[model samples]
Target: MSEKPVVRSSILPIPKSIGLVWLNIALALILAAIGLGVGFAQSGLAAQQVILYTVLMAATVFVLLNYVAVVFEARAEARAVASEEDQEAESSRLRQLWADNRVLAIAMATLLVLYLILTAAIPEFRSIKNLIGFLVLELILLFAFKISGYFAAGRSAFIGLIVLFALIVISAFSIEGFLSGPNIKAILLFAAFLGIASVGQTMVALLGGLDLSIPFVIGSSNIALLFLITLGVPSYVAFGFILVLGGIVGFLNGVMSYRLQGQALIVTLGTGFAVAGFTQIMTSIGSQFAGNVFGTVPGWLSNLAAMNGRFFGIPFPPTIFIWLAIAVILIVGLKTTTWGRNLYALGGNRRSARLIGISEFKYWVGCYVISGVFAALAGSLLLGWSGGAFIGVGDPYLFTTLAAVVIGGTSLLGGNGGYGFTVIGVLVLQVLTSFLLGIGLEYEWQQFIFGLLILPMVALYGRSPHIRATV
Candidate 1:
């Protein structure tokens, strides 16, 4: 053994930029293939599609070769790390290289594995049509990962806009009639409702609180408003009463949660349940259904939210304008008002706020009260749209309101977001929902995808230093 010393040989390093070039080429081919496939799947492929797909075939060969190259490179890196004299330094370099090129590395590895599995196990997966569809989705995932960096550093809302725009582009190209006037109007109509419902949630979140009662209040108020109208009460009067009822609920939520030391989530959820139960009991008195109310909504009220309803002779619904107005007012008010300033201060740091003469009770209670009123308003407006009221009508808002708030880039930790962010969030969610539906995904899939989407957003914000740390 002493006659010959063994020499360890390290594999050659592969430049990370090579992986990027491969990825870009793959994406270009995939996009062309997707546009051709989706655009011609119904009708026979046009000459244009034929030519494009032919080009795609050639590109696919190029991509496959690149994938092989990536595999060899990865193997080289692994062997180099194992054979290096200074294992620690080599490992550090390997990690740094991965950190610098993770998107490409992950994309290459994942696509290669999936391609191998699909081609081997499922022959149909090799079909041009299926392959194009698969690649389209892969493009979207890669794009999402590439842009996720924008979610960090408090750039959530801005990045949200980018995502929304991308969604619109992709949907318009992929789904027939996606950008048509009717679909556009439908999206706005739905967005208006969610936006109004989200107002309170946005406000409450700005102060570091959650209101689970919004959906419950919305349901109860929808029932109450229709029931009151049926019982011959004036519509305006009934609407005002519902708003007052919501205010009362919010007041209780704020007072109790504040006293309980910021247990807003539980307190509001409990309050919502109680309100829903009480409303059902009351509405059941002369109706066959516990939470159903049938009545004619006033024409003016119907115009507020109905898609066919117009604003100033314009085809657009008044509800959109209403939401726009509310957004503008809240955006300005939150910036210019003493109340807004104090709320932010209180939400940011209660102890410091107290020292500055800001009363946490007053601001906290006020925000919750505002949330309640908006929720009730949303419910009543919904009556105008639906033509009948059901207690479960607002049930969807429970998730949507909070989702809109979070997606809008509002911080749950308080003192960081505004209604402005909520508006973008509402639009993004509405558009996303529509896109998902248009593509024929079921509701369950939509929910699943939404859950997946929120995780990374939460992680992005969670990476920030805690509020306590800042203090």
Candidate 2:
């Protein structure tokens, strides 16, 4: 009889990468040098010295762990000689493990490299707080990813929330006053604006279209609201008029883009430019600047979005609750309503949806109309927050709206994401911006970092087939 075949355990041996080990060592050495330099530059108080030495020790322990893991992996590989079939099977399993973990590994390496580079190159980054914050943040992310492996169904979504939690922790720990009442209120207030602004972009993306005109709509509506108010229109009345105008703009965008098929981006962008120019021209007829539209913001409107504004005697702003309400409504509406189902059907497969008697035209137009109304609402609310308006006021929304929607895991291809995800995305962006600002990063670096962060999400989602293809 043939000798019995040897069997391996279910868990695959950890794969080894010598390059990663070397990277860990290099980073450790750099970190040690930084620690020494800081010590020599200023031997501070007892507590400060303790923190510095603790950080160095943590780095040493981390490097030692990596080396120990690599050594174990090496020994395992050396002792694992077997038949050709077993060897091939083990190789396949190792490859699978590598594929599954390569992204996390690369992310960790990239972050560590950035940590070292930024700390060395940027004067602002050389602080002990920043060094500890970086380490803590990296560990949080690693823990989150490791825990995410247990719940495979919604791992990506869960990872986002975990990351948000991690950021909150890191920010609270590292920033002097990040969790202070004023700062918290500020973050929530701005998040409310972005969340509201993102509403239209989210809806449009769900329908497989983009409204580049959102920023323009935002700017124009912001100006228009103030202009109307200055013309003696009651604030509420002006608000209503502006919303209607936004809806009309949305209607035109939907109609024209629908007719043009693949030119939604171009059409909406052109429409936005035209609307912005027209609004600027109209508002500037008797004014000095295209962007300046000054008017007294109403008390009610101010209470709606101001950071100091309260909700039923609570310290929080009303805008936060309003956003929460809107998010809940949209989330439920998208998941349960007939219109929502039709919207998904239309987006997931237009041809099939038509066969099922769904009107693509109606849904498409309706989505843009909703988008326009939200953009207008955001602008109006922002007026209260800012107490004035400018033509470029809505400019930042151009990138952020899209980024929030995409970062929330909404497929740009449509029919796969919801307002719930967008809410998380909004929070993430707000917190991240606050964190960056706290750390003294410049605007350009923040934008650069944002772009880099978005690429990974795009690549991750792109790997999956679209909803239509899956169907």
Candidate 3:
């Protein structure tokens, strides 16, 4: 057999040209040394002793690292032949990674086109503000790309943030109300909505599945609550029941898909259609609540979604805190909990998970149930924030939630991901959309641009259908 060549996996065409990642650390250290030197020179004996000890401790770290490098080098040389095999195997794995994520490259090229077009279109393109913004954005891109690899889950988030930051800087100088408090608050309120809804999508994506029923689930759940309140059910009781109803829908999805061994996407699609029909029925039943207008949602529900409220002198949507709370729970649970670990295991490799005694059925059921509950919760917020849902109330979220999930860096193929990263992605996307709208793009164009951006994350982060080659 001819010798096999190893293919390396890399999303970036030239990944290492990014920027000086350690620049901040180096500057901080230099500043610290100068400050300490100055202080130590003029300090009393006791203060001098403390400063000297701190410097010695920092110096020891460098010495220890050098010693470690020398020892590692000697050991590596001794294991040269074995190391070669490891490298070959690693290269093959990397090649597989690249194959799985090749779509990311297409996305990158597409975005570059978009950036160039936007640059020319921008009113301030030749202005100092534009030049300064692009310079800063380029530097950020360099640092982000340079450090990106197996360790980070928020590659797209970092990229999106840089792009948005550049826009903010440019717009602040040119646009009359660009960075004003109202505009910023408006952007954040929308982010609050998109980000909260994305939590469900992120959960489902982590299990390597998609939930198409979210729109209907959310719409129907909120409308159902209104319908129930009309029937004299207590508002709080209706809320709880609506939540459980959503979970029931998800459970059915899990059961039918698992038993039939059907594709999850198809199964969820079927459930979504069913829920959509149910929403229509609920709307018809609740039509009586509308005397002249459509419906009268509870005061408390409306209050939660109110954006004019001042919380501790900071004007923000009361519901924003709710998203923050959910984010904290998800981040902590996914990072530190046993169930969370098993979740990744199941998403990563179902067959291997089962071999280790992880109940595939139960975890799958749990993941969807969690998704359903959150979707229902989001529906209530949507109703309050948007002043109640109609046939298409959940329409916007279908794309926005998915976009946030993908951009947030949760793998669509399952396993590796978390909520904190997703939140950053949510803000990035919301900010991006806001900038596009500010630049006078129509709604369709705004959607089109974001829709375009979403493709890269899905293409790059997806991990499905493992492949191997031999010749």
Candidate 4:
């Protein structure tokens, strides 16, 4: 008797680009139809119009999310050595888990329907401004995701770039007015703040030094500047004073690290803790506003924070340009200037640098000073943006700044990174955080996500040639 052989069927669905492309195309058409319908009618939010908008948002979310899922799924597979069955099992679980994308899509759709029918919908929902914003945003994401497939991993920043775009696309669908001019600008502004702080971090990383006290320095500088302003110092002068204060802190860090030699981490950490404790004391005793200290910082300072002005058609503060300028200066100065070249060499190998007459000690002081000054500058800018600073204002930035530098592909051992990489990392973290918020994740959840993410990124770089954590 001949027994029929049983064939094992794979459980996981394979990655199919054609299907994702079709899904994106269909979503695009739906969004277009919704925009056209809204465009054709200049009037109220009727039941039919609400349904259309709701569907548009949901479909947009579905496509954007699925696009990201497929990309990640493909990445996982490429990185995997698992058996076909295991891949299938994981794929199946992902399918089940992410099906909530559709469910949540429907849920948001339903919520929109009910909200529009019951309450008065805001006029902003029907505006062409929103339509154009969304269209432009989606188009960019779709294109970026498409382009990302062409690049090799670790060879470029394309992965982080597209991942950011996909997240923003989903945010546009999930968070109302997320794609609008104001929200996007707000994200950029925050990114700029991180960029400012990252400048110091980048330099320190370049010199194979770490500044753990950055958070407190930034927070304290912010409060100190406000304290100065209230004491009748000019805003510009107050700002300068904080920068000087930051330099002092950085100088202290350098002196300690230099004296101890290879103890930059411990020195910076101790200083950071000390500064943080003092800042807390100051916050408790300083002028109060709504249960928190409100420095009487001047108006124009706030204007920079608020990005009150714009060039041509662009929004104000122009923080991106500021970040770009900082990066450019760092690159060129490091390339063209003797100090910059020495700094890189010093970072690359201290013994060799000293042996070659690079003046390692002087470079160390300058590097730390630069780091401190930038930290203070970042703090002051943030204070202006937020109306004032609090005790923990710079706390989150400590980790975020390090994560940004590392993610930007800057080597932990130093002498092998750029501001461009830091900027990309800054944008990635900012966009990810923003998207998580848009999806209604709480603060704790956001922190959890950062923790989960930062480890992997560090681990990825930690194995590279320049990683010398013990050193």
TM-score of each: 0.79, 0.86, 0.69, 0.64
- Predicted structure 1, TM vs. truth: 0.79
In the predicted model 3, the residue pairs found to clash are none
Q: What are the clashing pairs of model 4?
A: 12-88, 309-316
Best by lDDT: 2
Ranking of all candidate structures by their lDDT, best first: 2, 1, 4, 3
**Candidate 1: where is the Cα deviation over 4 Å?**
1-42, 46-90, 96-154, 457-463, 466-468
lDDT accuracy of residue 103 in candidate 1: 47
Residue-by-residue lDDT tens digits, candidate 3, 1-471: 223332233331221212322433354466456445544554344676757755775565444444444454444454464556766775698899877545655655766676666556654333334444544654554454444544354555555555556556756764568788888888877788777777778887877888887877777776777767767889889889988988998898878767767488888878988887866765575355421125678877777776675555667777788888888999999979989888888778878789999998998888788778877887877777766555566778777777777666666778756677688778877777777677677777677677775665455443334211110
For 227-341, candidate 2 gives per-residue lDDT tens digits of 9988999989999999999999999999999999989999999999999999999999977876788778889888888878878999778989999899999999998999888
lDDT of 1 at 298: 91
lDDT of model 4 at position 368: 87
Q: What are the C-alpha RMSDs, in order, of all predicted structures?
A: 7.0, 5.0, 14.7, 11.1
lDDT by residue for model 4 over 154-256, one digit each (tens)? 4236645654665666566656788877777878888989988988888888888888888888888777787767768888887887798899899999999
Backbone clash count for every predicted candidate, in the order shown: 0, 0, 0, 2
lDDT winner between candidates 3 and 4? 4
The TM-score of predicted model 4 comes to: 0.64
